[model samples]
Target: MIQHFFLLLSIQFRSFFGAVANEWENNRLKLIAGAVTLLVMAGAFFFMFRGLFRYLASLDADLFGFGTALASRLFGMALLAFGVFVGVSSLITGNSALYRSERSTLLMAMPVRRSSLAASSVLQSWFNAGWTMLLMGYPILIAFAEGLEFTTVYLSRGLLLYPLLLLVWLSAGTLLTVLLGWAGGPSGWKLFGGIALIAGCGAVVFFAGGTSSDLIIQEAPGMQLGGLQNFVSDLPGQSRGYWPHSLFLQAMVKGNGNAALILTVEAVVLAAAALTAASWKFLEAWNRSAVAEVRYRSPMFFKDGGRYSTVFQKDLLMFMRDPVQWSQLGLLTGMFAIYVINLGRFPMDFTNPYWLAVGVFINISFSAFAVATMMVRFAFPAPSMEAPGLHVLIQLPRGRELFYGSKWSQTLFLSVIPASILAWFSTMSIGAGPLLQVESVGCIFITAFTLSTINISTGCLFMRKEAGSAVSISSGQGGIISAFASVGFVLFMVGVLSWVTKKYMTDNFTELMLAKPVRDSILYLMLPVGFTVSIASFRAGIKNLRERVF
Candidate 1:
């Protein structure tokens, strides 16, 4: 059974690598862009850790010692949270896909026991959970210990601790999936569970953030470390029940000490036990319940409804019906909210219009990127969603161009217009003057056009297949590529606008300030050209789609 489990895991790993490699081959430029992105992210992490460590090192010896312990604890908490996030998202997405694949159909028919099949599946999930954790964690670990010697203690502790963290995350995810799978039906339960998990994680982050702040304050001059040391000492006793994070922290601070070793062993043992039990019980239920097909029947239509209007309504209804579409929009909205909140926190001198203009431009850029990304992910997948039904549509009196035009029109109405309104509102709220306001409006229009074109192009390029379940991050590289390209385009445009604004300010600040109409007029000129180019791109994409089989 163990051998079979290992064999299955090996096959899964190879399959994953092959999928990634194929994506890299198809989108080599985008893959390279992603690598560059990872590098930039790594650099940012390194600098952040360097600054943090430097600050810690500069403290008084007593304070440094206490802060180190606190930092370790907070880091452990972060690791646990990251693990949970990766584990939950992976387990849910993977289980949904696996349930659809019904791979158990083949495995169940084998000479092997059901328990072994379940174990193998669980192990596959663990690999996924572990890989996702490592992607973010390894960079952090490297950054945290920058300029430090490679001691055996550091290596051994990390090796032991990370596995425990992975186990904690995987076990928790497995247990949650099992419990949720048992619930059955698309009740409000899934939404409630998602909200609860997010809220719980947010609360943990807030507490950890506060604790970190306190630790920093304690490192200030003339502050005694006694209280801090006492707090650290009490934490271990109080957190005895929360062994995963505690044990990981202990291992980090004390390395391979007997206490740390014992905690590590306990965590691993508990994870294994929980996983075994969850797999044995959950697999049977999952196989049976997961295959139940859901049929959504539309309400009866009114006889007087116009065909064009009906098409639009159908597109809107379908968009709302898909949870993934709503989720993407929700994420973008959440990001925009965060951006606005952070911008409000900035203490800017309103007397300097340049500062306000810069703020508005930054906010607009963020909104544009968010809008473009959401459009590509949600709108581009529309054609694929048509599936076998597309043949029926193609056989209709109208050309495919008309069908494509209707879809694009729907995207413009539902995605583009809302995004533009939000961007303009955000800019105006940031106190942009009439000239800046006009420029902002033009920017929003251009952004909407660019996003629409990119989304349509992506739709034409990538043929969507029904993987029989919810989308996973690892499913395709097309969305990632489109997202990256959208962000890059936004950055490029924003950079040019910033440069033009700066040059205008430097060359004739007073004149430009006084001649608001002239400056606004120049900005508005960009709109027509942008719209023309975007429309042309959309048409080109349609032409490409006609040539392709999909």
Candidate 2:
């Protein structure tokens, strides 16, 4: 059984590497562009972390009097965040790699042990989910070493421990998918997942709300170091619950050989246990999942009978049928809800118009980034996802235009509503004046409009008909370009608006206090910028579609 599993894994690895080599050979420009984008992002993060650590090191208290303890706490929090992300990725990828994919079905029919198949699937999911983080992790470690002036020993220890920690997370996540599949099947798993996520978010809000009121009252006089100290103190204990991560921090940063040995033992044991459980019951779970059916009813309101109504309905159906899309969106919404809830709880002196304006600008800035993320994740893949129906689409009258328009319209419409809502609520919670509130909402609208155009255009320009998933396409070279473009634009707008608002608020403090407009403006001079960007993106998309489709 072990031999078979190793052979299968070897084949999978070879296939992956071969495909990567082919991509490099065939699309060197695109590959180089993507690599450069990733490098730039990593460099930015590296410098950011370096600056932060430099400041922390300079502090007499050594990071608010916590010393290495505080460093450990921060590292622990980072690990905790990464663990959650890896676990979610593993579960989603595991379900597909193990049970749902056509390749899995083919593998099941072969003359091999079910245990080997399950083992291979688990490892494949782990590789797919964890490899991307290597680039992210390396920069952080390098930054930590340089910033803190750590020796090679510390850096080496960290480099060794990170992948081990990732393995532990992968094992736990894979085991979860195995158990969920065995107990409730795939549909049951997704239902439970959605409910559990919603419940978890609710619990967080409840607890945050219960605790924040007193903290706000206590700190209302002024923000103090003590409250922050107490909060930081709590994190070490709270983070200890994630034993692997805590153990990793101890082993890597503190040079605890015993902790390192223990972590290694735990990782190996947990992996073996996961494999054993999969060998015993994963086959049964796989069989159960193979036969399960998911029935979803499409919305009744999609009955408009225009020339492109069918395209719209088809796109809606595609989106609705894909559980991954909606589930991730739900998670994003829950996280955003928590963010807003916490924002409202902050002890902001709303009477101070300057601070109020700052708060509103911050909210709008965050909302703009959120909108850009939505565009990259969901909107950028709209055109490529139509590959399965491309033949039919091409046969329709003015089909390319209809196809692109449907996707563009759908993306813009879906994007603007949420952007506007988030802006309004966030501003209202901060007690911004009516004029500023209107301005904030309008800024978000322009952000949405501009970003949607950029994403749809770039997506069409970089359409990959043979891609297996929306995620694969969205994480491609073109998606990186789209992301950078979106972020660069948002940063520019934020900078401009921040300067304008600060100037206006300073000049017309009394008048603004009376809830009056400070300046007659062409959107603080952002409208022309936005319009120019939108026109350029639209033209690029049209040119690409004409060349590709016609």
Best-fitting candidate, scored by TM-score: 2
Per-residue lDDT of candidate 2, residues 1-550 (tens digit): 9899998989898998898899899988877877888889899879988787656655534333344444445655666667666766777777778878776788777888888988888788888878777678778777777766642236788888888887787777677777767865545447448335533533442333122122211233454455445544545322332367667776777688888888888889878877777678666888888877878777776577776676778787777777777777777777776677677665555566666766777787888888888889898888888866676877888777777788889888888887788777787777666777777777888889999999999998988877467877887778888888999889977876776576657776543543333243334457888999999999999788877842
C-alpha lDDT of all candidate models, in order? 0.58, 0.72
Q: List the residue pairs that clash in candidate 2.
A: none
The local lDDT score (0 to 100) that residue 547 gets in candidate 1 is: 78
Candidate 1: residue 517 Cα off by (Å): 10
lDDT of each residue in 251-360, candidate 1, tens digit only? 65456365566666765775677556656655556655565444667767643586567776677667666654465466446646665545544545434556665676
Candidate 1 pairs with clashing backbones: none
**lDDT, residue 45, candidate 1:** 62
Error of 1 at 545 (Å): 1.2
Cα error, residue 132 of model 1, in Å, equals 6.2
Alpha-carbon deviation at 140 in model 2, angstroms: 1.9
Worst 10 residues of 2 by lDDT: 209-218
